[model samples]
Target: MSREPMRRTIRGGRPYFFADPAIDKILNMVVVLGSEVWTLRERLAAFEAIQVRQGGLAAGEIDAFDFSPEQEAKLAAERKEFIDSLFRILQEQVEEARGRTARAPQKPAEPVAARKRAVPVRGKSSKTAKRRSRR
Candidate 1:
């Protein structure tokens, strides 16, 4: 499968989507965190649904719904590793980019937006419409 090319800095040719590397990093972190939060929310919802069927919790037990201690620890470790690995990848890319830039001045690549063009949407019911028109 084909992959899209990485956008680079206008000055040092560092690979980054946004003009500022920090902005790109923050955007990626936000997306990753947002997805993690969504997954946790879904898990909580399912747990609560089960609780409701089994009978609502006792008073002052609002925080009582959830995973076992082991599961919680495992999840926390996974989340931490995910975040660490994300930053590590960004760091590696920047380092590699810096090395390349130091070797020689790099030429600017094509503008990110200009590389893509909007495609026209097609009707899903085209066959049915054609049949009706023929009749």
Candidate 2:
């Protein structure tokens, strides 16, 4: 029998654990990535142990390993997908904010007369005073 991984389906938005929801989401993503990294590390260690038991690998063999063009392209795609997933929450928030702004009714622009401007005073030594003196 094959087993399928159980997934948690979040309805609406996820509950905020911190004051800022973004912080909470970022922390969640970090923990998830950390768990995934730990799992991969454990698997690699186990695989290396088995390889040693069979036939010992050369020092720095894993580090020196190079991927083919095809493999590199595949890894690149996967990396892009991983990055998109990591920042998806922030992207969604930005999109939502944009949508709200688009739907909002904008205030009408004030007329030229209604807008605030500096009124030239006929004070001594002022531009108005100079014009008057010239006249």
Candidate 3:
């Protein structure tokens, strides 16, 4: 099978399956990351099996291994970076929302004659419209 190049970042909105788009995005990220983790786990298992076959490794050896302080520090940094990447989408969403709100209040003020008050519809409520818009 052919493989596609990995993307460092993805921008803009993604297609959503649920009424709550954030749920969809979170689910998608989980599935994608899960598959990647599974793949790495499989490869690691295979490598360990081969090492055992060659008499170079033993069961529990990896779990018992100790890391140096420098190595531990490096691993901690890498782990932090990996977690940040996993939730980068959420951060982007927050930033985008902030940008929208920040720009909203900056719109040019309209003259009094051009301003119109919203009228309530007989059967429809503004709250319902807002709820639908959030979906």
Candidate 4:
């Protein structure tokens, strides 16, 4: 059997690549956040595993189990730093994204008189509209 290649569809118009400084900064922040999150998760998992192993030792099933308080303290400190760094990165990303969005070009504003003339008033027939409809 053969399978078709998968394709992704963007919700809006064509995808836009960001090479702007603000965008680059946001991307770097995301990378930092991702790495910190991964490290924190792994460290927490290891701590949990250690706790489980220590619990088993209390039941006398294991001869001995040793856990260092200093190591746990160090991991806790590292976790705190990672969490703080993650928050900082997240804040920076939010600010950069906002800045990028704010800097985007807005639609040109039409003059007041031009705007008024652009719309067809009620009970009024436009010659341009009639000409186009005939074609």
Per lDDT, the best of the predicted structures is 3
Clashing pairs in 1: none
- How well is each residue in 22-45 modelled by candidate 2, as lDDT tens digits? 998899999999999999999998
In candidate 4, stretches whose alpha carbon ends up further than 4 angstroms from where it belongs are 1-17, 56-135
The clash count of every prediction, one per candidate, is 0, 0, 0, 0
Alpha-carbon deviation at 102 in model 3, angstroms? 12
Residue 115 in model 1: lDDT: 31
Question: Lowest summed-lDDT stretch of 10 residues in model 1?
Answer: 115-124
lDDT of 4 by residue, 1-135 (tens): 799887786667653368666786688789999999999999977766786677832433233644489988998999999998869857754664454356654746556897568455522433335446899
lDDT for model 1, on a 0 to 1 scale? Answer: 0.69
Runs in model 1 deviating more than 4 A are: 1-15, 57-135
Predicted candidate 3 versus true structure: per-residue lDDT over 32-118, tens digit per residue: 999999999999999988898898899768889999999999999999999999899788657644654566677766555553332
Candidate 1 vs candidate 2, TM-score winner = 2
> Whose TM-score is greatest here?
3
Q: Say which prediction, candidate 2 or candidate 4, comes out ahead on lDDT.
A: 2
- Report each candidate's C-alpha RMSD, comma-separated, in the order given: 20.4, 19.8, 13.8, 20.0
Q: List lDDT for all candidates, in order.
A: 0.69, 0.73, 0.76, 0.66
lDDT of 3: 0.76
TM-score of each: 0.31, 0.45, 0.46, 0.30
